[model samples]
Target: MKTDVEKASVAMRELFAATPLQLNEHLSAKYGAQIYLKREDLTPVRSYKIRGAFNFFRKVIASGGSGKTFVCASAGNHAQGFAFVCKHFSVPGVVFMPVTTPQQKIDKTRMFGGEFITIRLIGDIFDQCYAAARDYVEANDGYMVPPFDHADIIEGQATVAAEIAEQLPEGVVPDLVVLPVGGGGLSAGVTGYFRDVLDERAFVFAEPCGAPSLKTSIATGEIVTLPKVDNFVDGAAVARIGDLNFAALKHFAADQVLLLPENAICQTMIEMLNVEGVVLEPAGALSIATLDQLDPQALRDKTVVCVVSGGNFDFERLPDVKERAMRYAGLKKYFILRLPQRPGALRDFLNLLGPDDDIARFEYLKKSARNFGSILIGIETRDRSSFPELLARFEAAGLGFEDITENEILANLII
Candidate 1:
């Protein structure tokens, strides 16, 4: 019998063409290493999740499991993928998503599934929403299509690796393969396929800093759930790695995984859009973002492949992405200023700014004190060093100012 992954690879061609593996000259020159991006972002559902979803649906129908209703819980890419497959197969599906999910994703999922899928907005978090989906499956005798846990899903995702094997030039093997880990299906599938066919190939796993489930699990030699996950990288901010996926990835050393800060990931997204004209969602940029953490000397002249996971980014979040990127690069900051209640106070502060410095935000918090007022100021500058120079001027002028850029609570409230 043929391997499941081999069968899935043949089956996927019916849905869409294989995504490209393009060499990136810009990144290659910058890193002094050859870099190729596996553009899973260009999939029919704008994500690799569709591969697994389609395979799951196909296997179920082939095994005489047709006519069963399908159910899943997802706030982003997975839902869209599932919806697309549901419509393709002419099967009914129900997707449970958190109420807090962005309307853009919900609309996209709806568009994909059309009349074939029903979307239920339930609960405020994924856990609660997932529980509701599970209940529905049990109550209605529906088939639950899990995001990343099932063997069929893993086999389908491995098709990506199978394509890579065929697409690359004959007799060429990458020195390093980088994958972004959320629930770990993609990483596990790709790594398993490679480990079976190749010898001495290296793998790097990237995870959101806010949800380091894969890194933590690899370190502990078991699965570990994060107490809280920052959903900024919503596409890959899974709190826990799937059990089967963890078992597949457990042998890798902890050092092989890189935990990427949300802000840094934002910077990578911005860089790719601006420099390469590539649109990537936060999770899609994870592998590329981790490249900065690699040792330049070690990676020099090496062949590397970075999986560009998805492009399901909502344009509505562009401003937030830019803000986070600016803050991470230290080119923008917020300050709480205590200004003397005098006529020349504003003029004096204005003179302190450099030629390249621009005021992006200015607001008075309160004027209750007769002698002073609290002001919130946001400044953007040409470079990170400009901030230190501005702060020095503040010190020399005896101005009372507190850098609130790093204060998450206050920044969220005012900036």
Candidate 2:
């Protein structure tokens, strides 16, 4: 398997060169460790998925399946890779993407595949789209290039492990390797290739808290499908871990997987963009986010490598990202305040705000209420500690308010 991965990596030169595994000084200093980032984002398709797709296509053609039509379902990154491979191999293909997939991904897939592939927008979530793709494959006699699960796909993604092994600084042995998990292809491939060199305990997997398929499955010792999933982390929010991929990962305990919150991941994304000038999608930022969840003492003076899985970030989502980041940092909050329906009431509430407090939103829900009216308010402050003080001031001033920042249903409806 290791030899096959090396050969695949070498043959991959026809597509693109090996992505750099450069040390990240900012993260290294902060974590008190030598933190290296495997920049899979630098690929032509802006992700490591292309490696698997290229290998899958190459093997299919070599096996005398050149006339077959390929089909796949992906929320984003994998579709882009598959599209690129279809264009390169000059094979006809079809891509099925969820209707809710980001417009940036849809555009990129279309651009890369051009006339070689047809994209069908179906359903609103990945599972639904996947079902459609599977049906299409059976109906059309098309080969399915799964986003993860198959041996060829896993072998292709294992190239990342191969590259990291060869690219490490001389005489340096990594203490930990962090990887992001979606469908388990990348994590399975990476760990398989590193089985001889690294202890299984040295590997840590990160999954979105909203989508804990791999973590949940590993805990139950079976492939458990999630009943509901948050689509925020589009690339990594898989419903279930792939069967073959789970076989490779089942030996590890659930503790090996870190469940990251979507909001916290957003904070990491914003920090990376603002501090390091690095752009990453929610899924891509998972490995880096794992640093915050670790014991600092454990990472002290150790060498850690974070696999930055992808960088197909959509700039148009910056505002949403910033909103989530602020909430996660406790610097911004929303509330439904019951304000006295009088001229002096508004003035009183405004006077209660601290010097650093700024009103991001203020909307009266019932303007004509007799004595009290509900107002949806959003407040932003420089310090998170300031919110407690401001809330205290509200109480002392006899103002009635409810914090809706953490109330998903209310915030979604009113704010």
Candidate 3:
């Protein structure tokens, strides 16, 4: 029997040409490595998800399954990919998205599938929507094409690695390959192909710290569900690794996976946008952020390829992106201050600010006494070091304040 990787590559040709493997000079210079980006972000649905969707449907058809109706649960790029594939195969599909999904994403899914698909806004979270889709597919005798987990999906995703291998220059294999992990289909696929075809290339996986499903799974030797996940990086915010994907990835060392903080990812996104003119979604920046964890000297003369997974970023979130980047860089901060109820006290604190310091947010909480009150102050500076001088002035002047910049509870509720 032909291996799963071979089958995926065969199915991909029916959909479209391969995604580009272009050299990115800006990233190469920054990391001091000859870097190339596998531009999966440029896929038809703006994500590699379409590959798996197409493979699943094609396999179903090839197996002589008469089922023309397919169902899937997704709130993001996966839904778009499934919808597009459903249209491509001229098959009917039903997409179940969480009711909380943004209107923009819902509309995009509709546009991609057009008359070939029906959308159902079912539950508050993806888990509920997935359960609902499974129930519907079972009852209606429609095929339930999973966003990830199936053998075919893994196979389809592996085609990315196949293309990378074909696109590289003669006798050139990257020293390291980086991938962003969501449900693990893409990572498993690429890693499988790399190990099977080019055993010498090193592999690294990146997952959002808030949703470190793959890293956690590899560490515990079992797929573990996180109690909570930050959905800021919604594209790859999976709670657990896919069963099929974990099986493929089980052989890898635990240290090969990198967990990146969500805030730090924002910095990568902004840098890519401003420096390279790349508009990557939060999850798309995972692999890029992983580069920071690598030793520059170690990769100085090495060849590296990082998958820029998806660029389906909604520009409206740019303000939040900027805020997160600033917070992560330590150039901005929020503090709860105990201020004396005196006119000269405010003036003294103002004078303490460095030349580059600027007040971003200032609000009075409440007066505790005739001489003291609580204040919420947000400050920004050109450089992160400016905070030290600002804090020193607060100490020397005897001003009481609490830095709430990293306080998740207060930041979530207030900022």
Candidate 4:
């Protein structure tokens, strides 16, 4: 009998060609290791989610469960994948997404599914939308196709690992595999598959720092739900790991998972876009961002594979991504400056700026003050070191200012 992963792999070929496993020379050179990327971003729906969705639908049909309509709740890649599969199989599907989901994703899902699927926008967050979807599924006698948390989904996602195993040169096994963990479907599938096939291999999992569900769960030895999660890395900003997925991943140590800051992930996305012309969504860049956290000596001379999970990035978010990257790199800053109400006050402040410093934004917050006016200023510089020099000049000139670059509340309000 064929293993479930093998069967899923075979079944996947009917839907689309296997995503490429290509050696990335740039990453290899940077880390002094042979770096390979399992490019799940190249899938028909631009993510590995399709593998699980297809498998779920396939099994449902094969078991004479096709009479029921398939339902799912997602605002990201999973929705697109499920829609694509629905169209492919001519099965009816209902997708419930949060009202705040990007219009690009909504349009893409509609385009992929066409007449086979109906999209419902409800609620403000995933949890609320998910509850609505479940209610619909229960009331309508429909099948709830979970984005993760199911055995069939895990088995389907394992097809990615199956392809990796076959695509590598004969007898060549990767020394390390890095996976991005959201609700843990891809990580569970890939890790579980490797444990059975490879005798010795190291695994590193990456999760967004804002949503460290998997990392926190592994640390506490139990499933812990986060009260709040930042949705910047929308694809992998899961507040909790799936129950079945956690069970599969529980054997791994807490140290094996890396929590990546959202801004740093944006840096990785920008790097890939500028250097390799690869457009990766924030979650897709997680595995690559974790590379910076690895000890270079440990990874040196090792064969490493990083899963590029998805490329469904909206170009509309590019500006935000770039802004975050700049802030994370310390190349941009915002401040509130107290300037004297004098004719030469603005000129004196401008003189304090270094040669490489450029004022990106300057606005007078209030002009009512008799002695001094408050000014909101944003600065961009060629080097991070320029900030200290500029600040020193401000101190020497007796200028008063407060740096608000790292102050979330202030930055959000003013910058």
Which pairs in model 4 have colliding backbones? none
lDDT of 4 by residue, 1-415 (tens): 1288998899899999999999999999999999999999999999999999999999999999998899999998999999999999999999999999888889999999999999999999888999999999999999999999999999999999999999998988898899999999998898888886654338999999899999999999999999999988888988999999999888799999999989999999999999999999999999999999999999999999999999998898898899889999999999999999989989988888888999999898997589999999999999999999888988999998999999988877776
Off by over 4 Å in 2: 99-102, 367-369
The global C-alpha lDDT for each of the candidates, from Candidate 1 onward, is 0.92, 0.93, 0.88, 0.92
How would you encode candidate 1's per-residue C-alpha lDDT over 29-104 as one tens digit per residue?
9999989999999998999999999999999999989888999999999999999999999999999999998888
lDDT of 2 by residue, 165-266 (tens): 999988877899999999999999999999999988899999999999999999998999999888788889788899999999999989999999999999
lDDT tens readout by residue for model 3, 6-29: 767866887888899998898888
Q: What is the TM-score of each candidate against the true structure?
A: 0.97, 0.97, 0.96, 0.97
lDDT of 3 at 215: 84
CA error at residue 49 for candidate 3, angstroms: 0.3
Candidate 3: residue 232 Cα off by (Å): 1.4
Q: State the local distance difference test value for candidate 2.
A: 0.93
RMSD of 3: 1.6
Runs with alpha carbons beyond 4 Å of true place in candidate 4 = 197-201
* Span of 10 residues, lowest total lDDT, candidate 4: 192-201
